[model samples]
Target chain A: MPIDLDEALKAIAHPVRRDMLSWLKDPQRHFPDQEHPLEIGVCAGQFDQRTGLSQSTVSAHLATLQRACLVTSRRVGQWNFFKRNQAAIDELVRRLGEEL
Target chain B: MPIDLDEALKAIAHPVRRDMLSWLKDPQRHFPDQEHPLEIGVCAGQFDQRTGLSQSTVSAHLATLQRACLVTSRRVGQWNFFKRNQAAIDELVRRLGEEL
Candidate 1:
């Protein structure tokens, strides 16, 4: 099924999620460097630090974004690296223009 | 003050709000005829009918949309006519492209 706009909007409604997007824009600047910054995005630990939120809260927020298709993640070792899903973001804008 | 993306996204997150946007796209088709269709958008009664929600609920949803700057309203007699805020919607898309 196609993603609902309401669900997607709700997922990104939190301030932390917005901050996550900003941080993802310049991962190296906002987060600690990993072994492969290019291959792996920011880890949940780094995201928790940047947002000053509890690790569980950050994890929950990341899960929300993942459900909304706003971000994609890759498992590297015991860490999950997350990067903004540019295609999904672009598609959201396109759909809003068409639907709204 | 500039609108926050998080706030706006939260406001439009409700299913009723999304339905409101869809209804506003074709007011006459979804809503009952009023005195001035062009001058005023759909009223609460018509909206309540289309959404099958309580009047108070529809009113609250409209208020949410208004807060998000996704829709604008004009008072007509005892009724408030709400229309989609195209400019604000466009600006939202633009900002998402720039910021997201």
Candidate 2:
């Protein structure tokens, strides 16, 4: 099936989500050091600090992005590490080339 | 200058605009014959027929896409012909590669 462009667009519509994508571009600059931060992705608390939004709101936004397949998460112990899904991103670009 | 991802995303967020881009993909299939349709792009009336939207509403949607740099227009006598701007589309993809 073709990717749902509507859902993808809606997922990235919010300013905070857009900021999250921007921050993920350079995680070291936007997020704090954690154990194997580059290999493991940034933690949700780091996202909250970078965005300056409430922890709950950031958590919800990350959930939205994860559901939309824009980002991927890995649960390690108590923290959920979030990273940009390059495959999904490339798929989006490919679909735009073919569909748009 | 880098393309504005937010504005481009907002422009394509609408169903009609997305339809327009999809139609423009295969103009001959979606649009009817006109004087040099391929060279001149599809006219507003043909777009209205294909989309089943009111002429005024389709016109307005086309204008919105034009403003957002997603589409470009050419005036031919009394009718307006609109086509997808490939450069802008390519730029959007490029920005997505760099930014997102």
Candidate 3:
């Protein structure tokens, strides 16, 4: 549990990642309309642009979120769509509330 | 707010730090009797023994927690006593729930 907590905390410890989570919370508002369905989630390019960072950097950040179970990703053709994992975040908050 | 979140998350991201929080949850059970009152909190030497870490290492970890406002410390003679700041932790968790 500590290891999982460590991973989740480290994944969320960064400013960019924290900002990304906030943006990802309401992708429809933060990002431009996509041709694909919104339910599929926001693509990496949108995050890349908003972050003002390299695509690789944004991708790495997304991967960290995925690893921490804070976000879920889905591949759509050449693009990967990412969305917040609300359940995981809620559970993390609950655990942290209890533990901390 | 992001900077505060960054500090709080980074302070708690380490396993040792997280373990310390759990132990501090109930200092009476986790630590031996203090020559002083328990209300003052656990001394650094007790943490040093439990962590199996050097006193300097334990102190550094405690300092990070204090900087993040997750823990409070008081100087008692030659020793610094430390304990969890429940209100700050609750506030951080609340903010994280809202932001994340």
Q: Which structure among the candidates has the greatest lDDT?
A: 3
- TM-scores, chain A, per candidate: 0.87, 0.85, 0.92
For residues A1-100, write the lDDT of model 3, one tens digit per residue.
Answer: 2237888999999989989888887777898666677789988888878879999999899999999988889997898998988888888888887777
- Indicate the residue-level lDDT of B23 in model 1: 77
Worst 10 residues of 3 chain B by lDDT: B1-10
True contacts kept of each: 0.90, 0.46, 0.95
- Per-prediction backbone clash count: 0, 0, 0
Which residue pairs does candidate 1 place in steric collision? none
Residues B1-100, model 1: lDDT tens digits: 4666876788767767877887788776776565567547877788777778899998888898998888888997888888998777777777776766
- Ranking, DockQ, top scorer first: 3, 1, 2
Error of 3 at B68 (Å): 1.0
**Which regions of candidate 2 fall more than 4 Å away from where they truly are?**
A13-16, A25-29, A35-41, A74-79, B14-16, B25-29, B35-38, B75-78
Off by over 4 Å in 1: B26-29
What is the TM-score of each candidate's chain B when compared with the real chain B?
A: 0.85, 0.87, 0.92
Question: Sorted by TM-score, highest first, which candidate order results?
Answer: 3, 1, 2
| Model 2 Cα lDDT, one tens digit per residue, B5-94 | 777877777777888988887888776565565778888888777778898998888987888788888998998888888889888767
Q: Which 10-residue window in model 1 chain B sums to the lowest lDDT?
A: B30-39
lDDT of 2 by residue, A50-100 (tens): 777899999999998888788889998999998998777777767766667
Docking level of model 2: acceptable
lDDT head-to-head 2 vs 3, winner: 3
| Prediction 3 global C-alpha lDDT | 0.86
